[model samples]
Structures are given as structure tokens and as C-alpha cells.
Target: MKLLKVMLSAFIFYLSFIYGASAMAQDLSQQNKQLLANFANEVFVKKDLTNLQEYLHDDYIQHNPIVPQGLSGFKQFFADWFKAVPDWQYRLEKIVAEGDTVWAYGVYSGTQQGDWLGIPSTGKHYSIHAVDIFRIENGKLAEHWDVIDTYGLFKQLGVIQ
Candidate 1:
């Protein structure tokens, strides 16, 4: 009857609406995953900080105890570290994305050529595993929380044991 037809039409519309919303969320998740991968490839591997504003928000927040907050702070910290170890490299091992958040795990390798962590360099190479979680907002990185294996880095550098 007419009522059955109208009910079926409404059910179909509801199904389509649910699927559309799910598809949009999936698109956002995929886009964020690709963005984070490119960030690792560009910033971490290539060491290109030329267009920071394109990737990071002006008020970027950092949660690492050693690194200061804000985009300028992040840039300055990395710049100093890079200068101390000109041959630094980051190798991404894994990346995970969910909604506006992305998590990355990687190993950072570098040879010390100058002072690091207030300790004099011995010109030795070291590798440290690190994990970072980033929050994306409006297509830009807005916040970051990271954990680096500082003890491993220090021991590898012969600072301890």
C-alpha cells in the first residue's frame, strides 16, 4: 500500500544518510594519515622546515618536557639540534591515524658534532627510538606530544655506561 511505500522510502533515505556520514569520516581519516606520512617524509627525513606555516599552526602546542611550546619554539629547538648533528636522520617505522589524531613511531639517528643535552660531543653516532602523537585542526598540525628514548640516546652517546 501507499504507507508501505512511504516507509520503505524513508528507510532507504536513512540508510543513505548513515552511509554518507561514515564515508565522510573515512575520507577525513585517510587524508590525515597521508598528511602525517608526508610530514614524516618531508620534515623528519628531508629536514625541510622552509614552509612550517604550511604544516603547522602559528600557535602550535608541544607537550614534550624538553621541547618548548609554540611553533617558534619547535622550530628553534629543531634548528639547534640539527646544527649540532648535521647528519641527523629520522626513519619512520609505523604510523597510525584516527580522526584528527596521528601517531608515529620512528628511530632518530645522528652523529654528534657539537654540544648536546649539555654534554660535549664525542663525534660518535647514536640511534634513539621516538614516538609522537599529533593533533590536526583545520588541515594544519595544531598540537603534538612526543616521547624520545633519552636514556638510550645518552647511553649510546657514552654519557652513561
Candidate 2:
């Protein structure tokens, strides 16, 4: 009878451990999803940088060649781009989060009215599709990588045939 009781107690403890970990993971994923949504709305759609620090860690790493590494670089890239494309807008189409990673698919549209990356303003309009992947750490964006349709963007801008 004592052996039976011990075995039952061990089984209950194992079940609780498994279920508790699963619940914690689910909650983290949900929180990360919400974080990305708010960040996109405030920074991309609204073009606001006042709260950038709240979403991005100071050592944030960017894998895009056009943009430099670190949080300061990310901020500078956007600030310059915003001036170059006054009507620039990013529309998030889909987003998925798992563990500490989040993926966002979106489109970027803008009209060039100022210089950008040595390309003078031609008043040309361009729309590009891009998929961005981000890693979250301590509830903030720690790293970023993206796949953008540069060929299509350049073709639309009349920079290529």
C-alpha cells in the first residue's frame, strides 16, 4: 500500500511539472506577440520614435546590410529614411511568434523626395515586400534579420530595367 501511494504521488508531481511549463511557454508567446504588434503600430505605421527604447534593447543587432548594427544605427537608418520618404509607410500583413522569436511579413511603400543611400530624389514611388525576423530578450527586441525584395524596389524606382 505504501509503494502504491509513493508511485501515485510521483505521477501527480510529473503531470503538474509538465503542465506548468507548457502554460508558462504559452503565456510568453502571447506576450511577445502583443509586444510586436504594438511596436509595429507605433514605430512603423505612426512613424513615432519617442518610445523606441521601450521596444528595442540598447545592443540590438541588425542583419540588414543597408542598416548598421546596434540600436543607434537602427534609429539613424529610420530617421534618415523617414526624411527621404516623407510618405513612407509599413503595413504589417502577418505575424507569428514562438519561443523568443517572432516573424513579421509586411509591405513598404513610399515616394522618394530626398536623398537616400547616395540615390538622389527622383520623385519615384516604390512598394516592396519584406519578411522580418526578430529575437526577443528580456521583453525587448535583441536582434533582427530581414528578407526584402530589393530588385523589385529598384525596378519600380526606375533605377533598373
Model number with the top lDDT: 2
**Which lDDT tens digits does candidate 2 get at residues 1-161?**
99999999999999999999999998998899899999999999999988989999988999898998888888899999999999999999999989999999999999999999888897999999999999999999999999999999888878889
Best by TM-score: 2
Residue 24 in model 2: lDDT: 95
TM-score, predicted candidate 1 vs. hidden true structure: 0.91
The digit string of per-residue lDDT tens for model 1 on 25-80 reads 88998998888888878887888878788888999988887787777888888888
Query: Residue 115: error of model 2 in Å?
Result: 1.3
lDDT (CA) for every model shown?
A: 0.89, 0.93
Task: Give the runs in model 2 whose Cα sits over 4 Å from its true position.
Answer: 1-5
Off-target runs (Cα >4 Å) in candidate 1 are 1-3
| Poorest 10 consecutive residues by lDDT, candidate 2 | 152-161
Candidate 2 clash pair list = none
